[model samples]
Target: MSTIYKSEAGGREIQRLYREALDTWPVPAEHLRLPTREGETFVVASGPRNAPPVLLLHGSGANTTMWRDDIPSWSRKFRTYAVDLIGEPGLSAPSRPPLNSDALALWLDDVLDGLGITSAAIVATSLGGWVAVDYAVRRPERVTRLAVLCPGGLGRQTTGWIVKALLLRPFGRWGLRHSARAATGLESPESGPVLDSVVATFMHFNPRTERLPVFPDEALRGLTMPVLVIVGGRDAMFDSHETARRVRQCVPHATVNLLPEVGHAILGQTEPVAEFLRG
Candidate 1:
């Protein structure tokens, strides 16, 4: 077991649960493992093989399961590949290449090549959004369309939630649930199962602590592809207003959505994002 988890038992549990989630995937899918320099990459492929390709990247500490709610809708129109980011709590290898280096971009290049793709649309969230933006900036021609949600690297990241989460850590499961709620804004009774899964994961998972390198205005301006950025105004993580302003000013042609009531986790964007990807 990789040291990304607190212990071997915890690692086993996380994998078991992930497998269970995979078993319950709502659509017909093919699980594939692609060899890359970063390590073995895991992808769940769905939709018609001949349809246009759409790459799905999940946020930090998450796996392809993050797209489960949206895949059914997205796969209907396009071939969707939900990639389990390396180093996250997923089936992928635990190879965490430095974010400041070009390693991740190269890893993604290997991923695209392995998928037999020359160009594809990308839908990513949070850390995955950072990955997509980095790749677009480095290899703009390979990305057909770009859509991101609450991604890092545009606005300054906040540590207030980190302090809050740390202070509440010793209180056990209740504390963890509150911490999850504080970060994600999923507080209703209906969000219990979601919160429970988050708590369960954090019980073992060790999330990356490095501050994501912020992209310069020059880098943001290099995104000439069709772009869409969706962020939460009340996000406890990144400064969404700054993110929105920068995207508007830099990528003037980009579509930006700022949801005032939402937080770091932006939910129910399946149809909106689908429309953007369709275009």
Candidate 2:
């Protein structure tokens, strides 16, 4: 398959930055490579060996490092496996599978089977949320519980947001930073470095351009596992209010939280997510 990076040098720089970010992980982590049908998968394992397992799936354009701030707290109770989703900017393979099919479900099955995890609690954000939901619906018995932050595939994406993002591309760093902050609802200090990495990745890598597909209500209703749906009231990607409402209405056992002041970022909700996972 073709590479998603613009060039080899660009890919190396992104990888270097990724390694640098991984170094900042708050707790000790063990890096592992698991062979899968899609390709070789990269996972960062932490916490006790005997504890219950929790799988961490990051948003689009992000990798295992997305959980840097959350891993320390989660590792204290549960064994956490932070995966670098294949096709993203990480150590994982660059094979781009079809997003609208069961490819992701199959890929995840390979990862879990390779790791010998019979079942795990899934904690995901954005695109990763879509993967979690897809896997849960396809293999309900393998997922103990599901906790998603500002996930897609629940409601339609906003066209205005897409247009705004496209428009910002031509204006350079200042514009990119502004757009990133607006989408995340994050301000200076907290958003500075994060936005820098985000902008750098966009400039250097060829991120998937297709929008995440929305799942049908029937498909969502098929999920029998306990579900926690957290959406930001100010999220620019999708209609968070509508997403929460639909999830609550369709998934009878789901617990939905809509943070009015937040956007697409999940930085502050790690504790709540951990508490839910513990139970």
Best by TM-score: 1
Candidate 1 residue lDDT tens string, 112-197: 99999999999999999999999999999999999999999999999899899999999998898888899887877776777788
Give model 2's TM-score versus the native structure.
Answer: 0.96
Per-model clash counts, in order, read 0, 0
Candidate 2: clashing pairs of residues: none
lDDT of the structure predicted as candidate 2:
0.87
Score residue 267 of candidate 1 by CA lDDT.
Answer: 86
Tens-place lDDT digits, model 2, residues 46-106:
9998999999999888888878878889999999999999999989999889988999999
Please give the range of 10 consecutive residues that has the lowest summed lDDT in model 2: 179-188
TM-score per prediction, in order, is: 0.98, 0.96
Quote the positional error of residue 160 for candidate 2 in Å: 1.5
Error of 1 at 17 (Å): 0.4
Q: Which stretches of candidate 1 lie over 4 Å from their true place?
A: none
User: Candidate 1: deviation at residue 71, Å?
Assistant: 0.8
